[model samples]
Target: MTRVQANLLLLVIALIWGSAFVAQAQGMGVIGPMMFTGIRFLVGALVVAPLAWREWQQLNAQQRAPGRREAGKITALGVLMLMGAAMQQIGIVHTSVTNAGFLTALYVPLVPVLGIFFHRHWPHWSVWPGGLACLVGAFLLSGASSLQIGVGDAWVIASALPWAVHVLMVGRVADKMAAPFCVASGQFFVTGLMALLWALAFEPATLQAVQAAAWPILYTGVMSVGVAFTAQVVAQRYAHAADAAIILSSETVFAALFGYWMMGERLSPSGLAGCSLIFISMTLIQLIPVLKRRYS
Candidate 1:
C-alpha cells in the first residue's frame, strides 16, 4: 500500500480506538473493570488467532519460526497492556471518557522520556517543550486547577506510564518479530489470561453481568483490539513515523467527540485550550525530528 493508504488506515484505527472509549465506559455499568478487560481481550485473541496461526504456519514453512525470546517479549507486552487497560477501565468508571481519552494521550510524549531510563537514549529536543505543555495541559484537562484532581483522572494519568513502556517495548520487540499478528495475538492472550485470573479471584462475573456487557466486550475486543491493532501493525510498515504518530493522536480528539455525543461529557473552555496545546505540541514533537532527519 502507498503511504497515503497507510496513513488513512492509521486514521481509521484512531477512530475505532476513540469510539472504543465509549464502549469501555459503558461496559463497566454491570461488570467490574477487570472482568470487562478480561472478556474483551479474550475475545480479541479469538478474533485474531486465525491470522496469527496463518503467519505461524508461514514462518514454519520458511524455517524461521520466532524464538522463545520473542514469545517472552510478547508476554511482557501483554503484562504492560493489562496494566494500562485495567487502570484506564477503572478510571473511566469514575471520570468522563473525554477526560480519559485526552489524559491517555499523555503517553505520546512519555514514550521518549521512557527511552531515557530503559533504552539509555535521549529524546528529540522538541520533547522538553512538549512535555511541559503536556504537564500544564493535563492539569487543565483533568481539572487539577482547583488543587484537587479527581481520583479517576489520576488513575488515567497513572495508566499513561505503562502505556509509554508498552509503546517502547512494542517498537523494541514486536517490530522485530516476523509476524505482527502473532505478536498481537500472543500479547492479547497473555493479557486476557492474566486479567481473567484476577477477575475470577476478585470480581463476580455472572451470566447476567456478562450478557449486559456483551456488546461492549465484542466492540472493544473485535473492533478495537482485533481490527484496529492489526491494521496499525500493517499500516506502520508503509507509513512515515511522523505521519503515523500525528494521525494516531487524532484518536484523542475522536474520543472527546464521541464522549460528548454519546456520554454528554463537556470540557470547559480551559480544557479545550488544554487539548489544543497538547495536540499541537505532540504533533510538533513527533514531526520535527522526522523532518530534520529527512532534510539533514
Candidate 2:
C-alpha cells in the first residue's frame, strides 16, 4: 500500500484505541483486573477465531507446519502481547486516560531504540533530543510533580517496555508472516487460555461481573480489538511506517477529548503542555525521513 493509505489506517486505529480507554475504565468498575482482561480477550478470541482459523488453514496449506523454532517464536510473541495487555488494563484503573494514552504511546519512540540493540539501526541523532523531550512531556501529562511513581503509572511504564518489545517483534515477523492473522490468532488463543486458567484458579466465574460489564466489554472486545485492529493491519499495508506512528500517536489526543466528553475529566495546563510536547516529539520522529531526504 502507499504511504498515505498506511498512515490513514494508523489514524483510524489510533482513534479506536484512544476511545477504548473509556471502555477499559468502565469495565474495571464491574470486574477485577485479571478477570476483566480475561473476559476481554475471551470476547476478542471468539470474535477473531473464525477468521484467524481460516487464515491459519491457508497458511498451513501454503507452507510447512511450524517447526519448534517457529512455534516457540509465536508463543513468545503471544506471551509478550498478553502481558502488555494485562499491564495496560491494570494501569488504566489507577491512572488518568491522558496518562495511559501518553505512556502507552511511548512505545512509538521506544521501538527505534529497541531496534538498535538488534539491527544496530540507531535512530537519527535528532531522535535522542526528541525522545527526552517526549519523556519529560509524558511526565507532565501524567501529572507527576515528583519522581514518585503510582502503582498504576509504574504498571503502565513497565508495560511500555514489553510493548516496545512487541512492536519490534511484530516488525520483524511482519515481513515473513501474515502478521494480522498470526498476531490476532496467537494473542487471542494465549490470552484466552491464560484467562480461563486464572478464572478457574482465582476468579469465581460469576456472571454478575460479566453481566454488569457487558456493554463495555463488548465494545472493547469487538470494536476496539476486532474492527480497529483489523483496520490498522489493512491501513499499514498502504501507509509509511513513520506516518503510521504519527497517526497512531494521535490516540493521546482522542483519549484526552473522550475523557472530557464522557468522563468529565479535565487536564490541567501543565498536563496539556506535556501532552503537546509529546505530540510534537512524535510528529518530529515521523518527519525525520522526510527531513533527511530533503536536506541530507
RMSD for each of the candidates: 3.6, 3.4
Give lDDT per model, in order.
0.78, 0.70
TM-score of 1: 0.82
lDDT of 1 by residue, 1-296 (tens): 87667767887898899899899878978998888888888898999999899999999999977888888888988999999988887888788765775678677667666677787876557767766676566556655444434999899899988877766666446456768888888888999899999999988779998998899999999999888877776776665443455457667667777988999999788878767876787567656876898999
Where model 1 places Cα greater than 4 Å from the true spot, the runs are 1-11, 87-106, 147-158, 234-250, 286-296
**lDDT assessment of candidate 1:** 0.78
lDDT tens string, model 2, 185-256? 566567767866766687565788789999998998888867776565556555434344445656766777
